[model samples]
Target chain A: MEQSGDRVTLGLDEVFAIAKSVLVAAGLPERQAEPVARVITEGQRDECHSHGLFRLPGCVQTINHPRFNRAAVPVVENTTPAVTKVDAGFGYSLPALEAAMPLFVEKARTVGISVLAINNCFHFSALWPEIEMLTAKGLVAIAMTPSHSWVAPAGGSRGALGTNPIAFGWPRAGQDPYVFDFATSAIARGDISLHKMAGKPLQPGWAIDADGNPTTDAAAALDGAMLTFGGHKGSALSTMIELLAGPLIADMTSLESMDFDDGVKAAPAHGEILIAFDPAILGGGVRDNQASSERLFSAIVDQGARLPSVRRYEARARSLAHGVQIPRHLYDQVMSLPRAG
Target chain B: MEQSGDRVTLGLDEVFAIAKSVLVAAGLPERQAEPVARVITEGQRDECHSHGLFRLPGCVQTINHPRFNRAAVPVVENTTPAVTKVDAGFGYSLPALEAAMPLFVEKARTVGISVLAINNCFHFSALWPEIEMLTAKGLVAIAMTPSHSWVAPAGGSRGALGTNPIAFGWPRAGQDPYVFDFATSAIARGDISLHKMAGKPLQPGWAIDADGNPTTDAAAALDGAMLTFGGHKGSALSTMIELLAGPLIADMTSLESMDFDDGVKAAPAHGEILIAFDPAILGGGVRDNQASSERLFSAIVDQGARLPSVRRYEARARSLAHGVQIPRHLYDQVMSLPRAG
Candidate 1:
């Protein structure tokens, strides 16, 4: 691994090996470590930094906790042609989500739609990758997940909600799929951490201190609650996700017992709900749908329209063409970590 | 009708009478006037000021136009257990949406989900009422509609997208259905008009002038485009709606030529798409689903959780108990319109 600033450049193989080794060092079984490692590394490859290598440390710590039943497998207690429920058995979200994807895709093919509600799963990495996978198969996919407390209610002071994230993906014709992944929070926790690391103040109105006073100090904001993205609207979206992902899926009333540090304890287990729609089931099949999408998008762009994800796609392509440029410090931090044999 | 200041206090019956009579006088057959009147009146009752009585004069003018095809009716061209497509035959959206709802509900009851896409319709009124009707039947509903030029692309200037709105409704146990309805614009067109009426400057960053420079002047903002809420994320959402409601429903793309002033000549043959889902089809049946949702919302609230639509619901209740509080000036404007019969 070569150290840049806060980023490290490693061959994909090497990155996976190191991640697996780290998980093993943290007491995960060798058998389970590889899959977890692969999932995380793939996230980095896809440029989902928040859920990529940056989350390895957290995952390792959670896996090492005796409360987390890493050896347990997901159990499907109920299923239908279009819906399924997976009990994660206190295992990480990666395995459960991985197990559900194929089932979801299969069901969608038959019924034109499918839903998978995963209960008792750990933090799944960036949801967009999973959405991307579904969209690549010409299906429209929406994934929602809730977190431990990080967001405040509309006008209240205490952090009572998570920065619940929702993602949607749509397949396009002759262009990159339109993928939208966003947190309901004004800014991501990773961005807050970064600002803190850089000794920079947060923008005003992004967060509130414990006393409910808005503040721009990154450290204080960290100790407080992140504001919702679009005020009450974003907060409402987060609340909706919590109801759908946490309570509805896990059969819990609220996330009161979900402590940020209890990555091991499964009380008030985090959940995820995914809904998939197959375009072929509609009036036209996938090809026809694609053509329609193409025509509309072309007309808009021809009429001086700009698509939201176009810039990100362009940036990603450029980064891929010239090796991902990582900051020296971040690179050094990753490189300095002990490597597995 | 009594004019109070610039406001008017017309009983619900009188308001309906005026609207129905105007549409009839404008050449719509008496039979079609009732549904159109019901839709507009419901908007006022629901506290959606902009889409309600405020739109009466404009709609009347459209109805009077010779090209409007006032007597056209929608035709259902496709049907499945859970999907339907209706060709509106170049009519108004109100009748088409009203006609599609019961069908959508019936299909969802059979298959646990249904999607109705209507093409060649005009701009529909407030979406929440339609969602409210669906949720009352113990189903989740999502509605999307595409409108004329109002919103700009993420980074570029010029209006290329509509203030496409997406509304979602979740049926809760014993609670008023959770409804989220908002335009994707940072500031809705109604807000801009209100600002102009009040002779107030809009908040900076909410809109851009025709040349694409950010401005707070209401007139400039009116000539310019509204920024998408939450920047790129909101823009992505708006684009998704356009795809789903516009071309997916086989309606004209916003980039196509159309006249905005004359709904008959400039109308883009817009449409509405609705998706209804039954909770019983998932792992748990409807009862369990409702119970789970109840528990989740309670837990979040126990921890000071505040949801996005909670206040709106409260406001609605108050409005119901007392009556909708319309601004005096707006009331006067409505009452001052030339009466028919």
Candidate 2:
């Protein structure tokens, strides 16, 4: 272990082991604990600290619910030639999505495209893993999910939208997939919290004061609301995600999500949409796609612009090599938890 | 006709009829001219003058090509139980999309979801019509397509991305569907051209100087490149659209489109994607969806934020009742064309 300032560096294996033990201790059944732990571990591996172990304690709170279905299994309610609906039993999103992608791949290869609609899931993890997984399997995947409303509309004063995020993945044959995941909010709520903690002034357009006037004060913005990523366009994206994940999938809207809550906070139980495409049918087959994709990435990187997936993909390699640095307080809190029975 | 300063207002039917005559006179087949004309007239009705008759002469230049196929028809292939592909035969997008939406809607209603991948078409119209069509049939639809690269990616100077656009539509049983269409660029490139012509200063974040520094001088910005909406997040969306509508669909990318020219210039040859969702399978069926969708729209409208589709819908109604205005010079040019023999 290496300690520097307020940060502690630990090996990938150690992080995974700790996460798994903590999840089990948090009362997740072993079968469920491993996959969820792996999702958190991968976030840490990818250096997405926001979605990594920092989010695990909240996951535990939802899991600790008396009504939480420990042995819940995803149910396939309807299967057509091209689309499938998976009822995720109101559990975490990763496992359900993991179970659904193979079916989408098979359908897409045969028909050139497929859609897997997943409902009633707590989607707390980073979106890259599912998309990256499909891209590795030689497919193009697009995913969208909603969260509880925490953003105001472009001209409005109230929080009426989730940070609602969208993700996309494109395959490059023998290389890492081109992928990106982003929240439609100008700034994330967690980021605002961090800015407040550090007493840092925020950039313009990041948030608004209680009166709906734009503000540079982090604490004031925290008490008000986050702005959409690109003004009205970001607000539109968030609205679209909410509809696709809510009424379109027969799931709860952010406004409606509060009605179902019993005070145990976790990722909102939202629906999600994932569409996959077969490379052979669309991209002139694997070889041609690989060539074009590589050229595209080269153009981006040569211009000194980072491809969305490259940074995380490279971070994964570094984590396995030199390990990840975690804030000592965050690490200490997890380590202090009792071991599983 | 009512005169309004430099423009004249004509009935919507008259606008459509004149447009149809002009397109036919420009060498489009009668079979194809009406749809294309209707698309243009709708733009005028919506007060979207940029895409209205102002764009028709360019459409004519392309349609008048010696190699232009007046009988061009979309070919559907690679159909599976779940997905279908449409090759647009290098024609305009409106007719091809008009042919494909029915099949997608039927497939989605039966299978829970379906995707229509369209290639080899010139897409220059608003995306709402197609999405509105599917949503009217009680389906959720999302559409994406790419265009000429005129926007710079984040952290880079040269233009490497299109103002790639995305459109989404959600059903509302007794009311108009909620729909939206937007360019990925911070401001439409055409808007910049108009600003230049009007001697107007550009808005901040709208564009950059050739050296990539943000600038408010419209002329300098025009000499440079447009900025992507929301910075890095917008770049990611543009990249995703490129992959989906280009390599993933065996189609020409913006860069590649620029390479293929037979003298005549118009909308670039590109591909598009549209995915439709069956509300019944996910949203607890029809009545539940209608109620929830209406509530969602109510919340948006009640908060004083405009719903994307409502304005367009009302515009269509007003155009039908009170007519639309056309600039005299543009109207004169179209009227001067000889009717098709």
Candidate 3:
């Protein structure tokens, strides 16, 4: 393999190959490794850098831990026509989530809406991929996950909540579907790490130090707490996620569990909720729904309207057409990883 | 009526009476007056000043217009085992929303999840009252509405989208539960009005001028555009609401050719969607679901957790116990309205 400094720039195929090899070398079955690798690399290819190749090293490190059940498959704990709960059996979260997607889509199609809750699953990759997958099938979806404690309750001093994130997807007529995925926290944990590495101060109102005072210092903020997005409003939503994903799923929450370390493995536990509806069920079915939506959408545009995701969609289209440019630094970081089989 | 100097501190009962009288004098039926008065007054009693008694005069003014169908009741357009759509028939929104609540609750209890879509309604009062009612029944609820265009699309210089508020309620065990309601706009439209009334400049990033230039002057901001919460993310969510509420229910959108000044005369336009889910469906059964939610809620608290909405709940509790304290200036504004009934 050719290397640029300590990093390497590889095409999508090459990146997937590298990721698959690393996961297999870390004891994931060869068959399982490829799919997981594909998911991560696709995230990078889509320009979601925080969740893509940047996370490989950490994930590899996680897989090497004795607690990870490389061979385990999730088991269905309970399911109804409208809802399903899965026990991930302490295995990787991506495969489990992938496995649940069809079941969720199918159920929603049959009944207009469906929800899937997974417990005891390890880190799932970027939420947008799953939401995109669902929306492509002409359905609306919402997904949420709770992480280890990183955020504080509104107006409080210490960390008591996760940087919980929620993602939503909607299908529009005659345009790329609108996809929105965001963390409830003012800033993502990955951004904090980036700030730390660059020795940069965070923006005001982004975080609080250990004593609960708001701080711009990256290190102090990391030692302290992340603030919720939109103040108390965001905090309330984050807490709701905890209820849905934590106790609701029979999993340990950020507050109830120890830090996410090898020896202190909490239930590969997180929660995700999805809602999907068939527009066809409404008035004249999907076609009428589409026409009405288009009319309203076009009217808004006519009235100086701008649709959400229009910019990102345009950027993505341009990147796809002209080719994405990977920074030399990020390219090098990928090459530094130990070679797989 | 007794007035104190330039202000008045009417008791909650008196405030409700004044509101009811205004609606009645404006030609609303006496029977319909109580619900309208109750919704508006509850806002003040619950500390939501923006949507409380302050809106009474405007609502009364709207009611007096020949376009408002005061005698009309919301008609059920369609109903399924798990879904229903109501045509508000250009009636006052408060009565239409109130008429649909029990139906939504009944269906939710039967099917574990139910969706109710309301169309052709004017702006309803504060969403919290509807959601609070649902939570009190041990059901999770989400309510969203699309309004007149005021917010600009992300990266755009002009107004194109409505503030488009989304509200959620989660029923918890042994707690007041959590209620979250917020406009997608970075600052509410009322805030803009309040700033103009005070002759003060708005903060940067809060709004754009008529020409789409970011401005701090309240008047310019009002003439221009409002910003969305959380930048692109909030903008995306607002767009989704438009899709869900505007077109999804066969309602005429703000984007339609109808004049907003005569919105009350428009064919039952503008849509609202409400979703209710019984937690039991996910937790195996009703008891398990309730127990699980309660357990999760308590465990998080036990582990250095702070509940969301506790502050507001506390404020409300104190207000109820000791009575709400309205500022002298605000009290004066309410007393200035012409006497009715």
Candidate 4:
């Protein structure tokens, strides 16, 4: 972070330690607290501001809730040769997804592909970390998670889908995997909130106003529904994700999950889908798979393009040297939080 | 059939017969000719004019090539409990995909999910028909295929990605499945061609001209590369597709496939990825899956929006009665072709 004015940078270790302390104080298990911290750490490390330290309070809101089932542990509800369904037991997605990844990787290596469906978790972090974890192990991974409704279907007036993020990762030879994660919306709600704070005008088609008219006023658009990217095509992909991560996993849609939330400021029960394929087995073998990926990426990169993981990796390296900058006000809030005994 | 000004209407059967005759006269086998005919018939029936008779000539250009393997059959190279790879033997994708769908559906039912990688074929049909077959059988499907390079990456000057269409299907009990298919580019090339033909100005950011500057002039944009919808996010999705449908199946990317085409007006050996998930098992069962889907559709439809397949089904009903209307010159061309034995 450039240290000109209100910015204060802290070492990643300091940030992770503080986040872990906050999670424990919020009544999460020590084992569970660590992954959440890493999510926040990597978010800050990789410049994912909306998901990092700034969002800790929201995470705490759910973890500190009396009915949040803090002691629940995820379990594999069913298993096939290549598919597994995990009941998140109304916990957090990170621990559940983390536990499921190894199982998925093992199964994928055996059968060439594997799928893990995790339901009942409140996922509050960036998804690239999860997909990247698998891709780093030389596998191709696709993961999707649903959220409470925030986006309207194309040509529809109501907010009927989540910001519904989907991520994909491909393994590259001796280099970082090509990983990209994005919500299927024209813009994320957080970005809209920032624009509203800055009193900035929004772009056309990014959102619609109260009467369902397209608007460039950030505040009005925020009051309404976010639009899907690519018009009908993005809406179609989002709906597919709505089913795949929700009912297909015996969980619920964003609307259903919201109903179960009962208006509480807490984590709502939700669902996620993770599919991993061992490219070595799915393609020829390790060498052959690597060549195909490297061939594609080298061509793209030569033309001065940046794949998803590449940019994140660059930010990651920068932060490794300069540390993460937390806003002074947010840092004060972290300092004020009760520490774990 | 109704005779209207500037149009010639024929029964659906008549349209299919003509398409089949044309393909067979180009020396395609009867079995192979039938699927291509049905594709054109459905295109006309559903008013998908671009993919209908307008595309038939392109299909014929490939089919009539001296080196085209019209008699080749699709062969499954390997089958795991949940995955299968089919080599199309340098033939057409319609028959190869047709031959593999049963295997995929059966495997998905057994293991809850299955994937069929169909490669070495030239796929030229709209994807819905294939996914519709699965949804008709109560399966949810996702299929993606790569094409000749036509889309440029975000912030890049040259076209390095295909229009790369993807399709998704969800089963709806007692109704046509919810299916939608779309290309990842900001606009399809055919639409660009139409714009160029009509001398229309395009909406800004639809494409970029030489030197990578954004352009709205339809003719110049047609001479340039189409942009990915919503910028980098869509570009990422398109790139993910390029690898999955291209290199993963031991097939070539758009550029590679073009190189092997050797300037012939023939179909390139392309690849596709097809995944089938039996929601009946993936969900609680068929009823539970139906309830969730119906819940989603009901809410969206009440808002006066129709999912993709519903409109197609309506057109299908109309065409069944009114027949498909073939344009005058196109009908004349079809009439001029020699009839098959």
Off by over 4 Å in 3: A1-11, A30-34, A247-252, A257-268, A283-341, B1-18, B252-258, B262-269, B285-341
True contacts kept of each: 0.23, 0.65, 0.23, 0.44
Candidates sorted by TM-score, descending order? 4, 2, 1, 3
Candidate 2's residue-wise lDDT over B1-341, tens digit each? 77777888899888788788877887777767877888888888887777787877777777865545667887876465556677778778777777776676777887777777787787677777778778778788888887776778888776777788899988776777778899999998889988899999998988988888888998998778888998899998888877777777677666566455433456777778888888786565322656665766677777788877566778778888889877888777876767664
For every prediction, compared with the true complex, DockQ reads 0.30, 0.60, 0.29, 0.50
Best by DockQ: 2
In Å, residue A326's CA in model 4 sits off its true spot by 2.0
lDDT of 3 by residue, B121-176 (tens): 66657677888888999888888887777788777777667788888887867778
Off by over 4 Å in 2: A1-7, A262-264, A284-287, B1-5, B65-67, B262-264, B284-287
lDDT of 1 by residue, B1-341 (tens): 55556555556676688778767776777666777888777677666666677777777766665556787886774455557777666667767776777777887776666788876665547788788888899888788887776777777676767778888888876878878888887878778989999999999768999998898999999888888787777777787777777655455445431443343543345678888877655435323556556655565476565554576577557655555556786666665766557
For candidate 4, lDDT tens digit of each residue in A91-197? 78888877776777888888777788887787787888888888788788899977877788889887888888999988777777788899999988888988999
List ranges where model 1 is wrong by over 4 Å: A1-8, A24-35, A76-78, A248-269, A283-341, B1-10, B65-67, B257-268, B283-341
Weakest 10 consecutive residues of candidate 2 chain A by summed lDDT: A282-291
What lDDT is obtained when candidate 2 is compared to the true structure?
Answer: 0.78
> Ten residues in a row with the worst lDDT in model 1 chain B?
B256-265
